[model samples]
Target: MKKISIKIVYKTLLVSTLLTTFSCKKVFDVKPQDQVDITNNYRNVYDANAAVIGIYGQFQTLADRYIILNELRADLMSPTANADQYLRQLNEHAETTDNPWADPRPFYKIILNCNDAMANFDKMVADGRMTSSDYQQRYSDVGAIRSWLYLQLGIQFGSVPYVTDPLTSIDDLKDASKFPKISFDQLLTNLIAFMGDGKRYLDVYSTSVSTTGATNTSLNTTVDGYATNLFFINKRCLLGDLYLWHGDYKLASAQYHYVCELGSLSTNGSWLYDQYLVQNGDGNNHVDIYYGNSTDERTLVDNNNGGWRAIFGGGVGTLTGQEWIWSIPFDKNFLPQDPFVNLFSNTGGSYLLTTSQLALDNWNSQTQQNGLPYDARKLISVRTINGQPVIMKQLYYNVDATSFLPTSVLQKQGRWLLYRGATNMLHFAEAACNDATLGTSGVKLAYALTNVGVTRVYDNTWPAASSLPTDRTNIEQTFLDAPYNLDGRNGETPYYRGLWYRQVGSRTRAYLQPLPAALASDKLGMETAIIDEDGLELAFEGQRWGDLMRVALRRKDPAFLADKVYNKLLRDGNGNAAAVRTKLMNTANWYMPFKL
Candidate 1:
């Protein structure tokens, strides 16, 4: 592979600079300006603000390729006929040097921007141009973003040239002597250290000031008169992910727990649990199903669109929902137009990709809590377009009632969901389930998170617990004790019911049945269930491959990932399924070739 120069990599940066006057209303609306030397640009707060937005502008360019690499390479998505060889090669696991998505330059460009910003921020703080408080918030934000980008690079490319210093030329990267390539494990270690224990970094930014009148401004603040935390990365969430990939389950659980607790506090307790599925007066025993006036279970009625669908399509409210912790928004009016419209939409897009049969079959194979066939999230997540299954999560806010298609493509504005509530809860459960100290109790909590709420898991009368030993009552009470307990029933506080009292299991929220009690003590079984639940709940959102890779690596079982991708290919009728599986079994074939 030929080495590319930094000049060629960030040519766009040289042609136009993000020098627009800072406006809280137009947070991401960067305008083109004649090239100015960025070396002397970091002098004040507004400059820091512009620098942060500029970094995000570069980061926005990554949305399309990020989703393509993460999803298409996994089992949930496949290239469509319209897709070019570049995309098809990804699904086939045969990507060559020339594939556009295979290039690491785009990721490095954002890292470069982050590096430059952080270096300058440090200088500003030392020279007294930026206050320590201001530096702490902005510097940490840029650092977390950099960590996230590198993690993505590691996930896709196995070993990456981990460069920290802002490079004067891309040629420096070509010289392995200067920037030695680091393996994914090494990268995780470096990032974990960089992110620290999450104490020095500022938590969620607030709109309010301290009693001393010290401003608490951060990238999480409202933009365009609307509250938005989507533009910035969540520090704890990123740190937790780093720890998770590094095999530090206890630390990972703690970080994830912090995010969950913070979410509850920030949302006034309504954010931790999944939204309730109200059971209308129907003869059905399920909370999610509606049978109209008929008693027959087969009778069809209107499907409730607001339950899980609202998380994506609930408009501005979606931004504030507890589910979304970190996301990146794209506006058509902006430099990086909404990428998914072209990638996922058939009407207004080229439709380069579609939901794979494997994903569809996986959803269909599940039984809902109502004993109904298929999960309801499938309806909101995927839909038929021109007789092909299109991924609807990114394109539409809601499905059309009559056509069952997207009401319209979100052409003007769309979001790249990076982290959310399910991510926090499930990751915590995974860490707990794997931790040696937590044992079967940990497995029980993990099942509760995936199936039903904690209340039902601890219920002695619940059928699933009837087989347990009589001596287990005391152990179960410890789980229901203060601090660790999460009850789903109304309590003494007025807001208690509104908060956690309405809690349901993550899978339960999707109308899926809980895992049988037989697997509660089975660590591998619970881990597998958690990973599968990840797919059912968060599929097609750019996390499939990472989840598979992390688990496969932890267990030292290459077949874990190979089998899934292989089965997906077989389901898609791809002739390469056997070949791909054979190659993937070696683990070395899991990553793309590291070419410039």
Candidate 2:
């Protein structure tokens, strides 16, 4: 049977049994059924590995879903067509009344499963069935995943429960009324300590940490393939993330840099530094692994109306570039489609391109750096259908024959994007090219904090040129300086949280949207946590929303950018995507409903 069906059945069983909450008391009290017997399952490494892998798979889905709350909590997007209204209440920017699940029910399920697995795993070690080395790794893997999830929860909910012991009954698990809560800082501090312990174990286990980074396809494909670890990427990702939450930027940077170095390491001990690659084969280009070969890989369409082909408001997306330090590789298992066609997509209404102030500013600023052509690395190209050439963006060939644009190409509606075909967006956005005349028209913001809320306008006039620094760190910092919402530095003060919303594509800040009496103070009155949260939460996700309260606690009020982005493109599903559509229509979107 298809894993899809199995997944469906799993969810059905779980949801039915867990309407309000999974009652651990109920699980222990119920009659046992045909569950996989763990004793025999532990004899060999194969099944044991699979078990660990299973933990990883469950972790991936929920973990992926869990992060969305942070995005919502930080005002990255408002609840629209898809998320439960309860979730929308937590957007933090909004004057929310309440919801219960936000208390941490579902995510805990994932945590419990991991812990349960760890328990069984530790038993295997105690019996001498497994080596101490294996045992240590298992501990680290659990710590990594659990730490990650808990940290996210802490950030999303100021105080959340810190559950280490798996429940005696699976039934007692779901009763939200019975769950405990902890302060965000406390939970974070505790997890940090746990990770520190796990790190000591990890150090003694491996001869030396094998730091090779992973591409998206690999991690997504083997969603639960880690027994000792969920592959190096997650491990690397965890370590890097851990250091950041601990307020150890230098260590955090080192952790990420360590992975980057491992990725570049050669057998001879030399390093293969970044190779500057641009989309050159077609007018529209991207840096992506465009296909996957796994029988269970994520394909373009789930149904006739499903698939990447159906999601395009413009063209579907493609991956191609230096933007990704390390991504899933393009192999038989991934990179299934022709990346070029998807490049021309318009990503639903996001392609309207009227008020994306931040992108415009970043592009112009980056381009002007080092006296390079005023055009930033993100180029615009337009070509003829018959392999002919012309001034790109000329109205004649503009629509379908273009290249990279901006973040406004997608908007949230249940899922931020809803694209399907790679070609649907081909002919859109042709109207604006070097649109020196582009103004803040159709910039219909539903609400703003004061005036425009947070926003930034780009004049399109190339910035004053400066010399390019050869140092990679310097280059990264330069990109960091762009006045756009990013995820690495401080950003959470009310002022910072409201920055992007305030800059609604006008040089003049936005007008005020009435504040609720409940709101503590004016946005500007806030500290810089807004900037810090933005830097951390939206670091690579193509976003800038920061869970400001976390910032209020972390830095204690005032915050500023020191740094985030979201899904700009994808080559496959779960690190393994279907073939790239060479002849499909397109519409583009940023997110999809639950992978199922």
Candidate 3:
């Protein structure tokens, strides 16, 4: 009943590195016949325990890739700095797509994993290494995992080869020659049905496990085998996330909401972590997902690749956030955050990344007050420099994309409240209040207001003040000049010329940074075109070029600034109508093609 964050037992999935691995050992290696040496060896419960533990091991690998690629997919357009960038590309655009190179991987890679688990585990469930036993009964239970994996791929790609013929699709017949995904929605429908069948089959089998005399007495054995079921059960939650991607918010909301009900909220930190054999792998070293570091340890799970010191300079800060809900915990024995990881995670564009610099003129100045009160968040929430409440000065106030940053700007020491897994108790005190002024849709907002002694029916809609909230026209407005000089204690004044970023008056002028395409090459391992403009959201906004695409709101050009500034059609003196028409006609060539 104790809440435990899933991070302790989670892992990302991966296909075998060489064309032969399917997360764990090669499927062929685990084929019933190949296991000829091991099956006869499970004479005790310990061996059986390994079988289940292996399943969790594989889940960790699968989970890793699953979680990271998603970091790419977070909804950016929405308030969350999140975006389905890749998925959006896949969905909105077609054949002349930016990333067709990935066209079939998501589907097959998963199928390969599911199939591998099934084939290997099938032999054991049969109860006999050879002679026919209850294999059919257990196969369905195992199949649930496979079915759900297929569902994830199907929902995203539309058409996927069904699991009914997984063996033939992957083996007897060359999968290389077959299309891994078919674009019709029906594949999604069928795959979902398969998942249901697998789940039902599993439920019945679970009941059987509970009653049968064949069961072993060791509790850990049961817990370990739980991995197989974990793989399938987690899929149910995935189905919810997938539905949200497809715009079925109603269904998606219900799915997530339901999972919250069934799967008790995860505890902040968990201790049931697995330490795989991958050296330099950040996956382990963190025992649980509880908020705040119980002890600091560096992990393969680290964002910076062991170079935080040289990169971000020195002890910057640890990565902590309310959004993590779950995270790889670090204890010294487990992978802990190193000073290096701390340093790298701290560097940002300017005042945002650096620690307090009293050398600057106003470093010791009294805290600055919020210039605008129309928006209650800025007025009542954040604090001033010396010691008073004021609007938050950081860009993307509620969000921190960069992990490395000074504790001052990073808001590390405090804000730890967000990481608390406790329920009923408020995590964000601000959201609990109903600031008659803060645009909120319900009383939840008012709860926080009472702490301020204000009371009223919580208004759920955005208050008029928020509709057109006022912010510094540019970063410079706060300083003596414009964007370049630093008025805040957090950083040194920055300056650069023609580089598209530099100190100007008091603000950092906003312009599209040059994307030197030449820097890209197979040898360099850098992007051919810095799709991430590296301008507006430099410090932590993951990629920039994608943002320009979203901001311009042009479905046609994934290329930056050009769409917003270049009005090709009106170019006669005004603009060239013919040129504009020509570009529009050539839709396929517009977006900068990423070298996959």
**For each candidate, what TM-score against the reference?**
0.86, 0.46, 0.37
lDDT, model 2, position 189: 71
**Candidate 1 structure quality by residue, lDDT tens digits, 238-333:** 888888899888788777766765645555443344322111123222223334533444444333334455556545654225467777665544
- Ordering by TM-score: 1, 2, 3
Better of 1 and 2 by lDDT: 1
Off by over 4 Å in 1: 1-34, 197-199, 209-217, 267-305, 318-320, 398-411, 464-500
Number of colliding residue pairs in each model: 2, 138, 84
Minimal lDDT window, size 10, model 1: 2-11
Of candidate 3, the 10-residue stretch with the lowest lDDT total is 272-281
Best by the lDDT measure: 1
lDDT of 2 by residue, 1-596 (tens): 10110021122122222211312222212123524334345543333444444454344334224434444433223232333555433332222323543545556766776677677677788887666655666566666767766766655555555678766543464455775566655776787677665443432123232133321111112221111211322454455455555555444444433443332332321113211111111112222111133132232111112111111221212121122222211111211211212222233221111112233233343222123432211222222333322111111111222232222322211111211111010101111110113221101111111112222112111123354322222121112222111111113322222112112211011011122322212222222322422322122132233333323335443222111121110111112111112101111111111100
Model 3, which residues run further than 4 Å from truth? Answer: 1-52, 55-110, 119-180, 201-233, 242-254, 262-596
Instruction: For candidate 3, write residues 373-457 as lDDT tens digits.
Output: 1211121112233332211222212223242224343332211010111111111111111112222311322221111111111
Cα deviation at 381, candidate 2, in Å, is 16
Clashes of 1: 2
Runs of candidate 2 exceeding 4 Å displacement:
1-39, 75-103, 169-180, 198-233, 264-271, 275-554, 558-596
In order, candidate lDDTs are 0.70, 0.31, 0.27
